[model samples]
Target: MTLPGITPYDGKTLPQSKAVSATNVHEARTALGNRLRELRQLAGQTGKQLAESLSWQPSKVSKIENGKQTPSAEDIKDWTRITNSTSQATALLASLRTLETQHAEWQRILKGGIRPRQNALAELDQKTRLFRVFEATVIPGLLQTSEYARARFAESIRVFKLANDINEAVEARLKRQDIFYRSDKRFHFVLTEAALRFRLCSPEVMLGQLDRLMSLSALPNVKLGIIGFETQYTASPWHGFWLYDDDKVLVETFSAGLNLAQPQEIALYATVFEELASVASYGRSARGIINRVIADLSPDDAEA
Candidate 1:
């Protein structure tokens, strides 16, 4: 659903209502990366210098700063030593350990085995003022139907070797959709054309998913846009990212999710979102695309 500028937070509270929310592994990693970068800069250390001090390669420092790699606690301690901020380094090391504790593969949440992960997401869905989602390959979880979610989650479980709790996981996912219907919040989604047509489950299941997309696009508070595969974007084909207001960002990769908390990086993600929105189809044109996808599914219903 597309939420207009109107937010539950009054104009006065909008500034203060901004929050920092990292509901998953990707988000935490992003946040940690931002912190590391900030501490490095505050200490007036260059990436090359930091790497030399840490006895690691410069590329590794760059990857950590860009949220490309999940930094180990040892790496973080070294980063702090290079920056000459012993106290700050220790604090961040603790946070990183907390993030990595017990759960190593965050993708497991989708597959049905990570119950805590699923619940953490639900809790975030309860309070977020805005959800800015750009999906490169499939529907955002907030908008996914139970069938599609089950298929996606089940596949994740098998592929990742996570626990098989598809039934409970699917139920949690469906319940998570309540945020869309709530009058107090807003959800906006920017989907790649490939994602619009990506059939994760059966033809019937995809149809249901598309139909739901159409329905969600019509909501006054929901804004759904599709980026055609052929069209050029100002920020073309960036990795899938979910920006939750000014508080956090979830950057997805093949191996892990990066949670970003630093204000600068979150701002960067928001800027990218704006650029993506600028190039995407909206309103009537966007609705027409959704309708066309739905129409294409009608004939295949019998086959399913």
Candidate 2:
């Protein structure tokens, strides 16, 4: 799904410069800041005056107005109230929340390390009854083995310079897997064949992960589908996304995580998912593809 100000890219190529860049979030923040500034000026209050009235540091006002800082919901409310612009509070808060959702940078989210992020996801997992996941490259987190998960986390730590909480993060991730036994929840995972071949982790670790996928596929509550290279595609596998029931769709990018809750956005993703799922191989067919990958990894022990 496209974020505000960003143009949707064609599946074949990267978006051109005319398309909104990653700075959309910052630009959105700047626009909101300008609106707040207008409210203050219309109320005849200088930046220092507004800060003094709100009992905030003068720099807080300047940073916010300059889009260097994101104001919390309460901060927006206070600012609007003091400026006698309470009527704008609703719209301003909505903008702030949207910015927060669209600009959840991994660096900021993982500032406290990975475990907290894992815990937060677990909380969301507890609330979701059905998980519809599509992975274009790597295994989905819920279906990942500890070794595979550790490899993924290590890359995150390296890229984002996060704390070395790999052990705690891995434990929390495995804890989330407990939900797989609940029986009340359902999971449908669609993965492209490329997901199996990616060398994100060592061959041995990936073999274990493939074996885990084989076992998980047999669960009554889980449906695993693999889109082999031979399958004719009905939809372009542009990227991976997770659909938590019909409430929201989560898309992960290199820099940020997008949380989309708009009804239209969810509908679009659901439609694309069905198109991809229709072309995926399931049951024995899916297992055959996984087994082939396993054999390729360990040709000497295909029986193993």
Candidate 3:
């Protein structure tokens, strides 16, 4: 598919210049769509005209411009030629290709064995200055208790057949949280209520995990929000993402994670985050939700 030229939809507004590289693939795709569309409209070219010039299907052109499909390198080159914007097209296409490759499935990472990939997580931990996370499924590694983490890690090792260095894997994840304590850095966490109710581990482990989340919420540098299920709006429909300053967005999937480094995509993600944040309860209200759960876990109230 080639990059199409159509006006950006309402959701595709560009983010601030600083966050250009800190968005997800879907966000980048939207940004690219908007830019290509702008270029095409400037050239007074319709989707069909652009497609005819590039010898691509009109539907393909539409998909590219609409952010539904990724354009190949060859497709990008031809598109630039057709639009007579070679210089800008070359650089943009190169970046687009990078984004496309980064979205490869997690199975590929597993092909190289899970250890190396886990090590990469360690490296990322050392570099990121600020972490803004929205989790829908599980407790973030930074907030997960040891018992909960161990259970989750054990499952990962078993699934991936990664029997060696389990401790190293666990340690890498735990160590990543140390950034939360660094004076120069801060963490903003927004979690859906489902994450708390979902039982990734046993009741006792889950309770401890909730307790850990409560403690983290109390930290001065942390801004924690818990979005209730009954909330009216959510930026994301299902799934969540991690924004690391203006550098990148780590969009986690079941099999693998997508690292977004384009500015446009970063802005879209930021927008979504703002939407999700708006529907969330922060400060005392947020803490009260967790506190109620903790109270439910008390000795006499074990049934809950």
Candidate 4:
């Protein structure tokens, strides 16, 4: 019922932060609208005058100031110009961009080829000093072998009817693994036992990926944890999440990806990861669980 990081075991969204207003997209939009209204009033422009001057319908201006619609980037730039509040424009635009990007629909973000998405990840990947990943569906992309990655991308292509740009996308993802070799970075990965049972790839490919996981487990800077199926967890493994140090957390859903940057929101994911990690076994014990999953994929398993 739970996805891992987003849902509780009871299938509810956990209210992680006390300062929800700071991160709520709706609130951000409304605040921007109210601020615009205040600025318009300060400029001594009535709705009709401002709309006429800006070549906008009165209703469009009214809706924007009433928080019924979000302003486009260009609209905000021009709004500041019309209000003569150029000094505060940068900060306002930055907040607006953050709000929009955080709530961006996956369809819109993926309107271009998958390669761009993969490349965008590379931008964030290289700058990350610490990577903490929790997965409940399949192997984390950073830890997946090339064959395993291709299989996953194929499913994506089918779902989105995207161009068969699998080669470039996979290659870009593979390039991100370079971070795995960097001694300056640290990675902590945790996976639920259920993730191992998902057969996203052929048995041979999954086995190979499992082997790569074991090898990565031995890395001095990497810590891999596998929570056994029987283990009693301290907290729910709700949804898959990635924490980039203490600064950001990325939570993906069926519809969109959430970029949680508020300090409190990031801290909440860090806390959930810790709770999950506490129940997960590492070192040789973690490898033992992975080996069992590898064995489960044997031809004999199909017969049984």
Per-prediction TM-score = 0.67, 0.76, 0.66, 0.75
- Cα lDDT, model 1, residue 100: 68
Predictions: Cα RMSD each: 9.4, 5.8, 8.2, 5.9
lDDT of 1 by residue, 94-129 (tens): 777767642244664444465556688888777688
Q: Candidate 2 on 1-304: residue-level lDDT in tens?
A: 5555544544433333332223556677899999999999999999999999989999999999989888999999999999999999999999997899777878788999999999999999999999999999999999999999999999999999888999999999999999999988999999999999999999999999999999999999999999999999877788899999999788888988877766756776787788889899999999999999998887585455
> Distance (Å) between predicted and true CA of 177, model 1?
1.0
lDDT by residue for model 3 (192-253), tens:
88888887788788888887887888888988999877787634445678888878788766
Which of 2 and 4 is ahead in lDDT? 2
Q: What's the lDDT for residue 89 in model 1?
A: 74
Off by over 4 Å in 4: 1-23, 30-95, 301-304
Model 3 TM-score, 2 decimals? 0.66
Ranking by TM-score: 2, 4, 1, 3
Question: If the candidates were sorted by their lDDT against the true structure, best first, what order would they fall in?
Answer: 2, 4, 1, 3
How accurate locally is residue 149 in candidate 3, as Cα lDDT from 0 to 100?
76
lDDT of 2 at 297: 89
Better of 1 and 4 by lDDT: 4
In order of listing, the candidates' clash counts read 18, 0, 8, 7
